[model samples]
Target: MTHAPMADPPTTPAQTAARVLLGSAMVLAGTSHLTVARDDFQAQVPVWLPLNKDFVVLASGVVEIGLGAALLALPRERRTVGWVLAAFYVAIFPGNISQYLSHQSAFGLDTDQKRLVRLFFQPVLVLWALWSTGAWPRRRG
Candidate 1:
């Protein structure tokens, strides 16, 4: 049987820019999670969850910083980092939903429409994390 050809993985300037921007955003967001915006982040914690909101925020913040640094500093591990970061995005989606449902205004998401639209961006972020780090094409047969 003939084998299908495998093409080299590609990286574009746009992808590089996206990776840098997304990585920096994650670092900044993680910093906020630990520092000035800690209280604001608490608004997104679901009331149904039994865990302490502060602890959740702190833990997630630490995760964000680690993932961000990996994306930036670990070129060889970018694909793995991309996968982990995508899962992290998925894991935190509940917080976005919680924000929308509870009408908890934080950041610039001051209204229902804003919060709803912000919810849609989570998937985009997930995709960005994968695409920017070359994780998508690597999964092909």
Candidate 2:
């Protein structure tokens, strides 16, 4: 009986660059939450929510910064980071829905059309998080 040879582990300069670039982008984006559009971000918090708008914005900025830091700091944690980031995206989805449903404008996204555009972009951001962490791999059968 003959056994098939094992496949080599995947490694490419492009993959390395992709990982680094993606991680850097997340880190930068998360940091931006601290300052850029700060008021608009605070305003996005649901009015019925118990927390103060400033607190919400600050808390979310911290979380994003932490998550982004993790993605950049640990190589082994990339996959886990991807999953966590995906969950993060899922968690914040309601904010987007709320904005759309309420006809609310924030961060210069005025008009239903622009808000709808944001709705469409959210999933892409999620996918980008996934892709950044090398969550997707080509399957061979």
Candidate 3:
């Protein structure tokens, strides 16, 4: 009797590199949220939101570190991690918009044009998270 061929490994080197890069980015950003760049992150918080800016920054920083760690540690569950990360990116997008609309300067996005340009990068980050973790195509067996 003939046996079926084995499937390829779920993650390739490119995927691994993407994971590391994205994870590292998240960790660094999270660190910034909690420490030296806290004001920069706070500047993005929407004025209309009732939540305290510091609390939002602290919570999101914790989440970023957790998600970054999961991306690095959970090799078998990378896809799930990716979906969550993508969702996280989606959830935070309003901040990006707030920064643009309010003309709040943060992370060197001082000008209205710069803030507007920065707005477009959020979707790219979402895509990167999904692609890195093998969640974008809804992978099949």
Candidate 4:
């Protein structure tokens, strides 16, 4: 007996909502990176890096804003933007590690556990970025 081919999974409303939310969040966050919390970002840069905090902050802000805008603006470029955003996440990972190592206070949490918790979300953010881009592989019949 021949087996029947399986149908592609349907996109659920929830999934669509998630994509929209995630995309919106990225846009808002990227905008913030460009403006509102610009100084906060500069302070987050690891002191060990041999660069002025202002330059680093401005450069990173531009990248974040640009990537964020691209993700929102161009649907076709979603995959490319997702990869770039993922790279950005990975690139800044050391700053998170350094924050935890230094036991630096953030969001009013002094303990390393709080910082550790924040570090744990980095990968999640990366995944969200990828998902938002809708770049995951699909099975073909």
Candidate 5:
């Protein structure tokens, strides 16, 4: 008979806390995307994108909310959530690049140095998603 995979516990307490914090952060950021920070988020939307900035921001907000909620609610699927969240971080990275290159100020990253520094954090977000979800350092046989 076929069997379901078991929910794997986080490798450490730090991982658990990371998962909770990152998930909460995502939800909060998404909320801001659809609310007070809409214009700030729009400033980061690449000019080359054919879609409307507001629409893009709103859609991404919904996506973030869903993914964040999933990460928090689906402990059994933590690994998958981690991978997906990491990919999402990667997918949104171009916005960061655009913000830096186009000199679009938002979220207090007004200075070139600040924007450049922000770029470096994308990888950390990816790592955070992976580590928190126990997706990286793949299991051994």
Candidate 6:
């Protein structure tokens, strides 16, 4: 049986830059979830989720911190982390939708138009994660 190479393919300088930027951003955002923006993040939690909003916020904060650190520190696992982070973005989408639908204002998305526009950025984050970490690798023909 042929064993696959142990290492992930090398990323380009641009990809490395983007990954680092995203990793740093995640760490900062996670920090905010546990600190200054805790309440704001909680405000975005959907009431229907059943879990306590504060617990959800704090738990996600910890998760983000871990994922961000891993992304920064684990090049060999970058693709895995990228997929997971993209999934995380997808998983939390309802919070953004709830903020819009429930008319709960937080994180400067106080207006209907602003909230609507903000929804578009989540997909961009997903793409950024995938592309930066080579999860969505280019065709290798």
Most TM-score-accurate candidate: 6
Q: CA RMSD for every model?
A: 5.2, 5.6, 4.7, 7.1, 1.8, 1.9
Off by over 4 Å in 6: 1-5
Q: After superposition, which runs of candidate 3 have C-alpha atoms over 4 Å from their true positions?
A: 1-9, 138-141
Model 4 Cα shift for residue 106 (angstroms): 3.0
RMSD of 6: 1.9
Per-residue C-alpha lDDT of model 6 across residues 1-141, encoded as one tens digit per residue: 999758778889999999999999999999999999999998789989999999999999999998899899999999999999999999999999999999888999899999999999999999999999999969978
Point out the higher-scoring one by lDDT: 1 or 6.
Answer: 6
Question: Which model scores highest in lDDT?
Answer: 6
Q: Write the per-residue lDDT of candidate 4 for residues 24-73, one digit (tens) a residue.
A: 77667667666776666654678799998777777876777677667657
How do the residues 1-141 of candidate 5 rate in per-residue lDDT, one tens digit apiece?
999888776568788889988988999999999999999999889999999999999999999998889888988898999999999999999999999999998999989999999999999999999988899986679
TM-score for every candidate vs. truth? Answer: 0.88, 0.79, 0.90, 0.76, 0.93, 0.95
Between candidates 3 and 6, which one is better according to TM-score? 6
Q: Which run of 10 residues does model 1 get worst, by summed lDDT? A: 4-13
- Candidate 2 lDDT score at position 116: 85
Q: Higher TM-score: candidate 3 or 5?
A: 5
- Model 5 residue runs over 4 Å out of place are 138-141
Error of 5 at 80 (Å): 0.3
> After best superposition, candidate 1 residue 74: deviation in angstroms?
0.3
Ten-residue segment with the worst summed lDDT in candidate 6?
Answer: 3-12
Error of 3 at 33 (Å): 0.8
Q: In candidate 3, what are the lDDT values of residues 1-141, reduced to their tens digit? A: 999755324877898899999998898888888999999999988898899999999999999998998898887778889999999999999998998888898889999999988888999999999888887785469
What is the TM-score (0 to 1) of candidate 3? 0.90
**Model 5 collision count:** 0
CA lDDT, candidate 6, residue 114: 94
